[model samples]
Target: MTTYNTADHSDFVRQLYAFAAHIRDPKKNPCPEALEERRMKIYRELFYNNVESFISSSFPVLRQIMMHERWHGMIRDYFANHLSHTPLFPEIPREFLKYLDHERIAQPDDPPFILELAHYEWVELALSISDEKVEIATINPKGDLLDGIPVISPFAWSLSYRFPVHKISPDFQPRAPEATQTNLIVYRDADFAVHFIEINAVTARLLQLISSNDHKSARTLLQQISVELNHVQADVVVRGGMEILSDLRKRQVILGVRV
Candidate 1:
């Protein structure tokens, strides 16, 4: 006949979290003593492997370049430290990006382009499963884009990063940011295939203006760009912008003009 401490149950739960935390990053926390070593090892491996699999699938390029030890350490730190806002498994990759953006401090050995590359990879995955919808009937695929209001596709995104994220790979990681910014548009086509196109500063600004949906026609938007850019030849700028709009329509980035 023995009396159990009321705190014992709570203590066990706390210890379980502690042990799990330690399993994620042993350097930062201690292992629980209550669990058998063999069984704890199994729990640790199982949990770490599942997380590693998700991260690896989401960021295949990052995984290939990082040595196992460093990659595992980074993942472990994320698992242990980040307090994710969402509990959904599908959002883990996005949450990991948030952690990298907001929480993770840069390590001397870590590539400077790591955050940008991770963001680029995450955007691909995010757009792939996006539930956003648009009505095709409202768009005029062959409309005069210059005079008509250009409607940006719901699936299109114009992203600018300090690093040339699209080009970074294991073999071509850059230690420093390029002098010029990298501007890219990632869009899902009619076939549902996601693709990215590199664009210049003016085009990037034009997309931003179009996204405002301010009841401005494509010609007006282009004019605004030309004025803001202080181009010597506004008509030339507008004409070039018109061609760009036509190409964007073909790519489905600009979902034609609103009728």
Candidate 2:
């Protein structure tokens, strides 16, 4: 009887990955010849389509604009080159974001705002599925905005991007930055519905202060903002800050004061 080399078992795994890698990006790596061609082709189609579906759903806008060939090529490149940290299927979009952030380079044909737009889309999906919880019992839902310490909701995220990511589409691609920066808060409410709100620099700064220093009362936050903006009138800033905080609370962006 002929003895099969025991060492071939380890090599088999290496060969299988090599075969799949080639299928992912044939131009970058040659297909393995030892495997049956038809079987390899089946494996290729299944793997690529699985990854492609998730990417397409995650980035629908990005999908609609690109030519099918170019889009497939990019997806193949992602599958071949990127090493994802998570094995969970729902988290693939986040892994793709990491790939775009670190590994993938922007092609000449890709829009300048591709990264920001993808990030915006991912944020919506992320917030929608997030299971993080916050204490509601200790919070005073109708607390005074000026005197109470505002607690930011666990679901609230204050994001600043160079591009107006919410408005980006294939038809309206902007090549340069606008004079004003894009400041947005993406939050999930008590009903578990995610909402987006655009805020000015002053309000964004106030949220930043609240997040960074949870110990500070809303009045103290407003005072710090007054100093930062060099506003001669402190009371005016405090009054304006109250209105902003109250509006945010009504929208469930702020989960009321710590009681």
* TM-score per model over all chains: 0.88, 0.90
lDDT of 1 by residue, 123-224 (tens): 998888898988888888788899998989889999999998888877788888889999999999978899999999999999999988658887888888
Clashes of each: 0, 0
| Cα RMSD for predicted model 2 | 4.3
TM-score of 2: 0.90
Task: Provide the overall lDDT of each model, using Cα atoms, as 2-decimal numbers.
Answer: 0.86, 0.86
**Which ten residues in a row are the worst by lDDT in model 2?**
1-10
Worst 10 residues of 1 by lDDT: 1-10
Cα RMSD for candidates in order:
4.4, 4.3
Stretches of candidate 2 above 4 Å error? 1-12, 28-34
- The candidate maximizing TM-score is 2
**What tens-digit string does per-residue lDDT give for candidate 2 at 1-259?**
1123245568877776677567767666666878777887787888889999989998999888788999888887788878777879999999988988888877888878888888988998999999997888988888877888888998999999998988877788888878889999999988889999999999999999888875778899899889999999999999999989888989999988888
